[model samples]
Each structure stands twice: as C-alpha cells, then as structure tokens.
Target: MKKAILVAIGFILYGAAMWYYLMHGAQADLPVQFRGSAADPTMFMNDRQLKLSYDFSRIKDWIYFLSVPLEWLIYLLVLGFGISKKMRSTVKEVTRFSVIHTALYVLLLSFLSWILTFPLRYYSYTISRDYHISVQPFKGWMKDSLIDFWVGWIFTVLTVLVIYFFIRKSKKKWWLYAWLISIPFTIFMYFIQPVVIDPLYNKFYPLKDQVLKEKILTLAERADIPASNVYEVNMSEKTNSLNAYVNGIGSNLRIVLWDTTLDKLNDKQVLFVMAHEMGHYVMKHLYQNLIGAIILSFFGLFLGSRIYSWAISKWGKRWGIKGLSDIAGLPVLLLIFSLLSFVAGPVENAVSRKAEKDADRYAIEMTKNPDSAVGAFQQLTISGLSEVNPPKLVKFFLYGHPTMLERITFLDSYKHKYEPKELEKAKKQQR
Candidate 1:
C-alpha cells in the first residue's frame, strides 16, 4: 500500500513538473504563422515570398532526402517499443525511456530541417507535380522553392534560437516564452503571408462576379461576420479536390473558395459547408486554437528541453549536424513529436471536437435543412472511409470530433423528431 501511494505521488509530481516546464519554459520558442485568408494572394500558401511553385517531383526529392528517414525511424521506434512489451517493463520505466528516446529524436529532426530547408523550396513544389496536383512550371517552381526554404529557415532559426536562449537562462520559464511567441508570430505570418508566400502555388483571381460577391457579402452580414473580401483561388491549378476556408481576421478576412468546391457541390451544400467554416470565424476558434497550441507546445518543449538539448549537442557531431539546419536530424525531431503526441493529442482533439460539434449544430440550425446536412455528412463519410466504429478511448485520445457514426446518429434523431411535420410541410409547400 505504501509503495502504491508513493508511485501515485511520484506521478503527480511528474505531471506538475511537466506542466511547469511547458507552461513557463518553452511557449515563446514556437509561434503560429501560416493561415488562410480571402483576397490575400497568399491565401492558399506562402507561395510568392516563400517561393513556392508546383513541382511535386522536387518535393518528393526533398522528402526523400530529408523527411523520409525520420518517418522510417518513427515507424521502427513504434515497432520496437511495442515489441519491448514482452519484456514486461513497468509503465513508469517505459515512460522515462520513451521520453529520452523521443527527445533525442526531436533534436536531431530540428537540426536536419534547418539544413534541408533550402531544399524545401524544390521539395513542396515537386510534391505538387509528382502527385499530379501541380500546374506550375519549373522556373516558377524553382523560384518559389528557394523562397520557401529561405523564409522558412529564417523564421525557424529565429524562433528556435530565441527559445534555446530562454531555456538556457531559465529552465523554469521556458514555457512562458513559448506562449508569448505565438501572438506575434501568428499576426506576422497571417499578414505577410499574403505578400510573401502564396503567389507561388496558385493564381488568385478577385471575385469577378459582382453578383456572387454581393451575395457573399450579404451572407457574411447575415452571419455577423464582416466581409474583408472574397476570392476564387485557382486551386484547380493544383488539384481538383474541393475545399473552402474562411481566411484571415478583421481587415484581412475573406471567404476563399476553391474552384473545385464550386464545381462539385451545389449552392445549398456549399452554403452548408461555408456556414460551418464561418462557425469557426464567429467562435474565434483560430485564436482560441492558437492560445491552446501555445500552451501545449510549451508543455512539449519544457519536458523535452534538457533531453533534446543534451542529445543534439552530443550526438550532433556524429551525424554531421554542425548546425541546427542539419537535414539529417529531421527524423529525430519527428520521433519526439510522435512520442509527445500522446498527451497533446488528447488535449488538441478535445478542443477541436468541441469546436466542430458547435459548428455542426450551427450548420443544422442555420440551414434548417437537416436532410441536406445529413447528406453532406454522408458525403464526408464515404469520401473518407471514416470508420463507423472506434473505441471510446480512441475517440478521446485521437479523434478531433465525435465519431462520424455519432454525428450521423444525432442527425438521424433530429430527422425522427420532426418527421411528421417535415413531411406534411414539404407536401404543403410543394403544393
């Protein structure tokens, strides 16, 4: 009994220490930067200033060169860790071991990304082409690739260096800086991105249809969201998949729609989906999300600081990662993110699920066409092969929203509630 009590106490202390480290130590090191916005030429990506052009082949090369090793390393670690279960290690022992292993992996990855960022210019572009998703030429591709690499490198190095210094000066407050950095970084990335990043990936055409523009503005007014602008991004230039997102904030706001979404779905379905996106805007989910992210990232970094920093400095020499930009170390970082993902994953999913459920409710109420909403839900299910059944714990830990089955079930219940009135009303209205 005493031993069990001690174990419980130890875990409690560890949790508090983890919280303290993350909340106070590492927040300022990472910040939210990229986001979607209407009218912003860079709505889709930081293509222009970042120098992105569609060239999936080049992206494939970069990933092949840089991200692949990390991907494989993570795969192996998962397998190794699972296999070690037969050794019957206690959870605490595993936790400590995993923490060390994950931290070293993350350190290596950070250094590798710094090194391979230049190649990222070509990297993302190639991904576009190789996937048959790109409509960009090589010249545009090369230019964009370089921009992506350099800008990405600058932003990354600056933020990382800042956090590293803070970690050095005050291990206890590393998480505070992590939270603080997200505010400025999110704003800068949001505004400059229209100019710096998106032009390289796809063309931005102003909403040419005055009538459609007027309708969108009207919709925004009805939704109580201001009309920053509206745009039809040439997503067809890159891919035919449909999507829509309400981008930017305040003056930077806009309803950016992909042509594919326009082409595929009818107006009602589009409005239903747009309403969901608008739900995010009205709820200010993005900002809330930023805050949450800042908090979580700090947690991750605080837990990881000593482990990763030590590992990087020590093993860095062996892998030829003399600088933070060493491309070879990316896998290590991924391994860390993969490992720490267990905790943050649940927190993130909880927030997202709340937001998503709220939006689903809003869409149902606004459209007043629960049937259409149901159809849309079906579309999502079949389109994705989303599992209908998942363990409750899995939903808690991994799911960002209620399972699709639950969503469908809710809508079905809704349908049953008004079936008689709905049927009679439909018949009367038709007459």
Candidate 2:
C-alpha cells in the first residue's frame, strides 16, 4: 500500500516536471540559433520548403490522444500481459520472454503492413513499376517480406538482449551502461550495415548504363571521392520514392541509387542528390546522430530505472507478468523512453538541426550547384507531402528541417553571400 502511494506520487511529480519543461522549455529564453531553428536556408543545399505560419496544435493534440489506446496495447505486449498469460521469473526465462514478445510484435507489425499493401500497391504502382524500378513480381514481395521479418527479428531480439544485459550489469546504473554499450555497437553498424546488412533487403545490381556510369564516375572524380560501386536497388517491388544514399565505411562504402531516382533525375540532379548523401557520409552524421541518441537515452534510462523499476516490481503481477525481470522491464523501458524522449524532444531536435545544417553546407561545397540543389529540395518536399509552415511549437518539438519558406529565405540570403566566389570559380573552370 505504501509503495503504491509512492509510485503514484512519482507519477504526479514526473507529470509536473514534464508539464513545466514543456511550458517553459528546457531552455526557452535562448536565442533562435541556440534554441535551434530550421529557418536558416543556407543550412541545406536543398531543404524541405514548408510554409512557416501554419499551426497544427489541434491535430497534434488529437494524435496525442490517439496514441493512448495504441500505447496501452503496446504496453501490454511489452509486459507479456497481453496475448500470453504466462510469466517468467528467471533471467533466462525473462530473456526468452522478451525475445518471444519482440518477435511476435515485429511479425505482427510487418504482417499487418504487408497485408495493407494492396491499396498502397495501386496508389504507388507508378513509382517503380512504370519506371523499371524492379522486375520483381508478387513472389519477390513475399521473399522480401520474409527476409524483412527475419532481419527485424534478429535486430529486435539482439537489442532486447543488449538492453537486458545492460540493465542487469549496471544494476544500479543500467542507463549509463546502456549508453556505453550501445554507442560502439551503433557506430560499428555504420561500417557493417551497408555492406553486410542492407543486401538482405534487396539485391544490388551495378548500374549497367555506360553513359550514366561514366557520368557518375566523372562526378565522383570531381567530388574527390573514390570511384566505387554504383548499384541499383529494387525499389520497384514496392513504393515510389526516388532516393540515393552512400553507405558503409572505407572500401566497403558504396552508392545505392534507387531506380526511381535514376528514372526521374537528370545527371545533374543525380549529382546533386548524390552530393547531398555524400555530405552525410563525409560529415559522419550517422555516428554523431547515434552518439546524441545514446546520450539522451542514458538520461531516459536513468530516469526509468529510478522510477518504474519499482512500480514494475509491485504491479507487474496484476498484469500476469513477472517483476522487473527483462520481460516485464521491456514495457517499462518502452514507456519511459517514449515519454522521456518526447519530454526531451527539444534537445533531440537541436541535435538533428545541427547535423542537418552541416549536411546542407557540405552538400553545397560538394556539388557547387546550389541552384539545382535548391530545386531538388523543393521537389523532394512536394513529393514527400510535408507541410511548409508548421506551428512555432510544432517546429520547436518536431521539425528537424527549417520550414521550407525559411529555407528559401535563407537561400536567398545565401545566394548573395557566394555570388562573387562562385562566379570566379566558374570562370576559372571555363579556362
């Protein structure tokens, strides 16, 4: 009874703290730059051009309310209290319990999404099928689906074990342990991912067009990046988004260009697109972003350990689950991370804004065709159906990109900044 009262009090205090944080901001009085704004256009060579004055507070509120029931379902799943009536007490049983739950959750989510592909198939059919995105048929989709489920299971199961081990090892400071362990693993993922991991999703075939290949080669030379594999991915099996990316590290690094992008973008546009991804590559945004995540998660994990570790123990049985053993701990971590992540939303946005800014500047330097990049960004935003003008609060909490209008305004400012030098460089190149 006493413990229940304490847990209830803890919830109230956490709510109060979160409320105050949102109302005042973690640091509301800081300047726009320090506060993080996507309003600066020079931030990205091609940034999403969203309008700046629109507000979606009501919509966001509605979404927040909608999250409740779904969260409750997920909460139940994580705690092993939903579908299964059995509970585990031992560490090994807890680990198995966590893995089983994660697997089913992943499979369920994937299966449901795959089942929904009928409507999406027709809706996005033109994206790849019309453009020769892939020659794969329904069989291909099934194979890909199975592969995805297996891969997702591997990833989720491993992650669960890691989280469990960290919680066990750290005992008192599992949050700190989670951060330390995950950082290196996440960083290593940067190197191993594109080479060893991504091929599991789809087959990679070298772009066979000599003209296109030569253009890519020349661009690579000009960009001072090593000439390497340019592979086409089978995005045609589903979806219609044109995309390109640089993946892996060192000699393992390769470029995977979507057939859709190749179909839609001219060599110049493709170059601009590749350069943008290259910016992320050279800037090492992946690892840096992961580092930021780990840091924030550490705070979240610490708070979770302090608060829910006890509640989970006391009330875990009510839900037909074990105590703070790994299985039941899963839901607690999920809830804690979700809640605290949203609580620390501003800080995460700040990090993303910084990384994006760097990537933008890097893209400009790599492509030196700021005009094309700007156009590409506008089209990208349009294709993606992103809002141009989000509410100030929405932008503060959610937007990683400076609103599209802010982007254009910044670019307008930037074009003038580089006019003299770009003209000089163009003349020199002509010589």
Candidate 3:
C-alpha cells in the first residue's frame, strides 16, 4: 500500500509538471507573417483568437493530466481493497455458469468504472459545448454515453473470458495465445467498425454534390486509387469541428468527409483534404499501423504477464487473488496494462506523427496546389480552435500530426520553390 501510494504520488507530480511546462513554456516562435496581425488578418489566428485557443488548451491539458493519475489511482484502489474480488463473489452467487458469471462481473465492473469516471466525461462534453465546438444536446450526449458503456461492456466481457480461459489452460503460455488472438480480433474490429459501429453514431451517405464528387474521384484516379465513391457524414448535428478521414480495410474501405468540412471549404481546398485521405490509403498506412500495433501488443502482453506474475507472487493473497486464472486478478492485469500504455504513448505518437507528415506531403504533391493545401489546414485550425504551436513536450506526447504552424510553413516553402521557376519562365517569354 505504501508503494502504491508512492507510485501514485509520483504520477501525480509528473502530470502536474507536464501541465505546468505546457502552460508556462516558451511559445513556439511563429514568424510574424504567420502570426496574423490585427490589420492584415491572414490565415493565422489573431491575438484574441490565440487567447481563446490558449484558454481552451489549458482546460483540456488539465483534464488530460488529472485523468491519467486519477484512473491509475482508481485501479490501484480497486485492487488494494479487493473490490474486484468482492464483485466477482457477488456475481458467482447469482450465476453458477462460469461464462455467465464472467459476463455479469464485467458488466458490474464496467458500470462502476463508468459511474466513477462520468464526471470527467460530462465536464469534457460541457466544455466543448461551452467553447462552441460541440453542438450535441444533453439528451443526445447521454444516449451516446450509454451506447459507449454497453459496447465497452460487451467487448470487455469477451476479452476477459478469453484471457481467463487461456490462463486456466496454459498458465505459462497464456500471454502468447492472447496476443495471437488479438491480431485477428483487431483486424475484425477494424473491418467492421466502418460498416457496423460508425453508423450507430452518425448518418452517412454518398457525397451530395455531383461536381465535387466527380472532382474528388478524379483526384483519386490521379493518385492511382480505385475508389468508387466519396461519402459524407452528418457531423454538423454533433459538432462544429471539421475533419475528413479514410477508414476501414478491403471492401469496407471508405473516404468520408464531415458535412462541416464541405460547408467550410471550397472545391480546391476540399480536393486537397481528400487527397490527404487518399495519401493514407495509397501509402498503406492502415496496414503499417495495424502491424505496428500487433508488434507492440505482443511485447506489452508478454511484459505485463511477467510483471503480473511477480505482483501476484508478492501480494496475491492480500488482494484475494488465487492465481493468474482468477478473475479477481483482472484489476491487477488492468493496472499493469494501463501503466504500460502510458509509458508507450510517446513512441506511438511519434510514429503517428511521422505518418501524418508524410500524408500531408503527399497531399501537396498529389494536388499540386500548395495554396489550397495551406487553405485547408488554416480552415481546420480555425474551425477546430487548434493551437498553431504547442510546446515541444506536449507535441511529443499528444500530437499525432504536425502543428498548424509547421504545416503552413511547409506549404509556404513548397510554394516558394515553384514560384521562382514560374517567374523565370515568364521573364524568358517576355524577353
């Protein structure tokens, strides 16, 4: 217990220090031209917008910092107090069947976790609404929250059953087996998420504007992609933010645009955004990411199994856990996995950032319209209230793409590279 308390304190301090650094660190030195003076009012945000952006960022950063340590502490408390064991016992009294007992315990655990963490979720929703980022109604938010709860409960039950089954069957090799199972499970989820899960939240249909759809399809053809359709989702009903993405794999694959994106961007800018999504598809980033995730999970599960064994050997009796096969050990497993994920976040973000940067470059090269590419990012920043430049550590940990400043600068540099050649050609023609 003393060690748990010490570890929690350490995490709390670490989060606090990060929060402080982000809030107080030297701001990224964006060029004056990109900073958008009040008189010029260029693509960059003005002073007032920057102030609001920073204020929103601070709130979000605080929640992120608080949530990590709070979640870790909650898991620790659950394990240290044998709350999971108690819950498992309660479920066993209600159901004699092992599968049923596992499902009920997981349902109860999921509910309790939701109830405990709901305040943060609610605050996050309210803050987004307050900032004019989320337009979702309170009832709609609650309905979505419930859907998330049940969906999560179902998945957790299935995962727990699998883990415990392997634990009882092959105590030593269970981690390896689980990791192998996860590869197919992950792919299955990826394949189905676009067709099955996403529709539950938002309505989607083929792009309504034929001209724009044709243009996007032409752009895809230029990039040598065999896309048959461009889809648009009714996202304006939920949020004012803008986004576009490529999702799924194989036949379920899709290129989707948020309605807000179509409403805000012109045809050229929209084409640039679509080109960016195509970049992901053309570069096979999805497959790359899936392979990377599988590799990481393999190591994560192996290391977690080892640590879990060491921990059970030390405190299994105190925690009321019999062995690895015991469902009561779920919290211990969760605690270890959570710590591992937190430690791995920076590496994961770095890889994602690199992919995103490559995609951005592809977008410019494919479109041959650096101006529109710049415009697309500018509009995204304005609509999303994105920080043009975040602190380095914050970017390293949190950002999965280049900052707005970095993107715009790159576009500007690309534009300049061609402008000199164009000017020289015009001069020769005039002569």
Candidate 4:
C-alpha cells in the first residue's frame, strides 16, 4: 500500500515537473531578434571566415546524433539482459559482506560498462582525430582514458555505497536523504576537480610569458576577480581547440588558459576570452547552478523514486532485485537518472544559455572591446567547427551556449550608450 502511494506521488511529481518547466523554462522558444538591416554585408561570414574547406563532414554529424541514442541503448542493455543481476550475484558469492560486495560490484559493473561502451568511445575519438580536432596520439589518449576509467571507478564506489546505505536504512525516504547529501558532494566534487582530477591527464604550469601573464592578471584585477596567478595547460598535446576557464574556489582559484589558445589567438583575443571566463565568476554562476541543481534534484529524486518502484515491481522477480537496497538494482537507478537527465536537457540548456549570455555581456563591458569579442568567437567557430546556425531541434535540445552567429550578431548590435530617443528609433528599425 505504501509502495502504491509512492508510485502515485511519482506520477504527480512528474506532471508537476512538466508544468513547472512549461511555465518557467519555455522562454527559450522565443524568436531571435535582429537589429540593423538584414542586408548588412558584415552580417555574413566571408569565405576565409567560414572556412569553406573545413571538414565538418555530415558523417561526423550523423555519428554524433546516433551516439546519443546508442548510449541510452547500452544502458538499457545492462538491465534488459539480466547481466546486472548475474554480476551482482557473482560479487555476492565472492564476498558475503554487503560493503565488500557493493565495492566489488561497483568495480565489476564499471569494467563491464566500459568494455561494452569502448567501441563507441573509440569511434568518437577516431572521428575527432579524422576531423583534425584532436591531435593526441592514440596511445597517449588511451593512457588518459585508462586514468579516467579508474577515477570514475573510485567515485562510483563512493556513491553506490552511500545510496545503498540510505536505501537499507530508510527504504521509503532514501531518495530525500540521498538528495540532501548529494548537494554538498556535488559542490565538493566541483571544487576539487580542477585541482585534483584534471591534473591527472594534462600537465599544468604557470603561464610562461610574463608579459601576457601580467596582462591577464591586470584584467583579472580589473574584474575584481581574486585570482593572482595565471596558469596554462598543455592542451596542444590533446587538441587544437582553444579555451580558457576560471576554476576552483578560494585558494585553489586561478585562471587557466590552454597553450593552444595562446599559440593561435592574439593578445586581445586571449584577453577577451579570459574576460569572458572571469564573467562567470563575477556573476556567481557556479553558486547559482549549484543552488539550481539542489532544487531540481528534489523534484528529480522524488520522480525517480516513483519510477524506480514501478520498474522494480514489474521486473523485480525476473531481474532478482529484492528491493531498492538490492545491489542488482544499481543499473535500474542509473537508467532512471539517465532518462531524467535526457528529458531535462532543454531546461538545463536554457539556464546555461542565459548564464553564457550574461558572461558575454560582462566581458564586452569590462574589456570595452566588442571587436575583440567578435574576433574571439570567430576563431572559436573556425577552430572548433562550431555550427554557426544549427538546426532548430539541435539548438533547442543540445545548445548550452548560443550559436556563434547569435553571439556575433549581439556584438554587432552593441551600443555604448543609447539615448532613450535613439533606443526608440532602434526599436522602430528592428520592427
């Protein structure tokens, strides 16, 4: 009877999630506004700017598209074939202790999942290399991949143990307790990732060019960002793409630039990029996202609890899951989370796009260099093979940052100080 009540609550929460998003998160569908003449020659990219010969092949696009569904399919297979239960039993036989069995299952499940998913991963890398986006040698990439696998394994063990503990202790309210715990865990992971986890793959050092570093430090200071030193990572060894980011919290905080970005972008472009990254910190986007995640996790976990109960009720006997506490149900939990994430993409992207837009505006205002912002985005477009105008579906579902065209157009429309009369005139012109 209690299970039935939970299931009904899940359905209610799911409906509420949908309605909440419709009321609050559906603003992303609003039409884009263009100022100035549509026929303005500067609005379109020239041949060199567009990189006419760039090999952003349709095959690569299809591969990316297909891989999304393929990933969900793989997750489904983990549960559908009874592999999750069989592996759980095997680990149980090896160790009768719940804690040891959970640890063993985490390792076994990670290894099996990695093995099953490696082909798609290899193909994805092959495509990146084929398109000249990745410059890392296969052996080097594989070594990094191995490191990444073990790192993921460690985290999985920690998470699965906590979750099962909650399930065993409070079967009905575990989701609530787990969600509460995850808030701090998420923040800790974010805070530590730049310092601890990221260094495992790429080497980082202080920016070598003292002049450039000072310039970046000056910009950071001007932005009131607490970062004193600038760091550069050996990203050229991995990819030809350009990027810079401000990461970590408190003493661990610093601005990191990719060596590739330094090699390719001029000083002004690099400054603008740094400023954009600093904008994120100044705007407190990290804290905002954390708060948002905590809120959403409440709804998501509640809904997931309902779905989980229903799934286990239908498949529990066949899959050998005794209840939520059963180790065999790990895959089911993972699948539920994955599905919820997939469904929540648009709402998440809407929030991300707003943050990115705010950062762009802050960077422009701080640097007082609209042209540099435009040039920086153009460079990103060419180097990253970013689609300037993606399909509507892709834009709505997948895009976290606005398209290069939209960003450049915004820069083009920048006005330092438009009088009320001029603003009215501009609005008329746009109409």
**What are the clash counts of all predictions, listed in order?**
57, 7, 0, 0
lDDT of 4 at 158: 86
State how far residue 21 of model 4 sits from its true place (Å): 27
Write one digit per residue (lDDT tens) for candidate 3, span 133-192. Answer: 899999999989998988888898888898889989998899999999999999998899
TM-score of each: 0.59, 0.66, 0.92, 0.84
Please give, for residues 140-165, the per-residue lDDT of candidate 2 as tens digits.
76677677667766776677677677
Candidate 4, residue 200: the lDDT equals: 93
List all candidate RMSDs to the true structure.
16.1, 8.7, 3.2, 8.8
Kindly list the per-residue Cα lDDT of model 4 for residues 1-431, writing each as its tens digit: 46446654764565455444433443332134532332121344456544431235233444455555555655556676778888888987886788889889888888887887688689878878877889999999899989989998888898888878988898789899989899899889778978898899889999999999999999888888887789999999989889999988777786899998999889988998998999999999877877888888888998998898899999888777888889888888888887898889899998899999999988887776666777788777767766665555556777889866578777755644333445688899999
List, residue by residue over 1-431, the lDDT tens digit for candidate 1: 46446654764565455444433432221112212211122332344322322122123333433343344443333323332222223333445664343333333444444454445445555555654455667876666656665665566556555654555566557647755775677666665555446655667777776665676667777889977577788777555446677766556666777776666666666677777788888888867876676667767766665455565587655544443333234334445655686657777897898898888777666666666666665554332223343445446655787765566556555665556777999899999
- What lDDT score is found at residue 357 in candidate 1? 84
Candidate 4 clash total?
A: 0
- Cα displacement (Å) at residue 315, model 2: 2.5
Q: Which model scores highest in lDDT? A: 3
**Model 1, global lDDT:** 0.56
> Model-by-model lDDT, in order?
0.56, 0.60, 0.84, 0.77
Runs in model 4 with CA error above 4 Å?
A: 1-61, 415-431
Poorest 10 consecutive residues of model 1 by lDDT?
Answer: 30-39
Q: What is the lDDT for 41 in model 3?
A: 25
Ranking by TM-score: 3, 4, 2, 1
The lDDT of model 4 is: 0.77
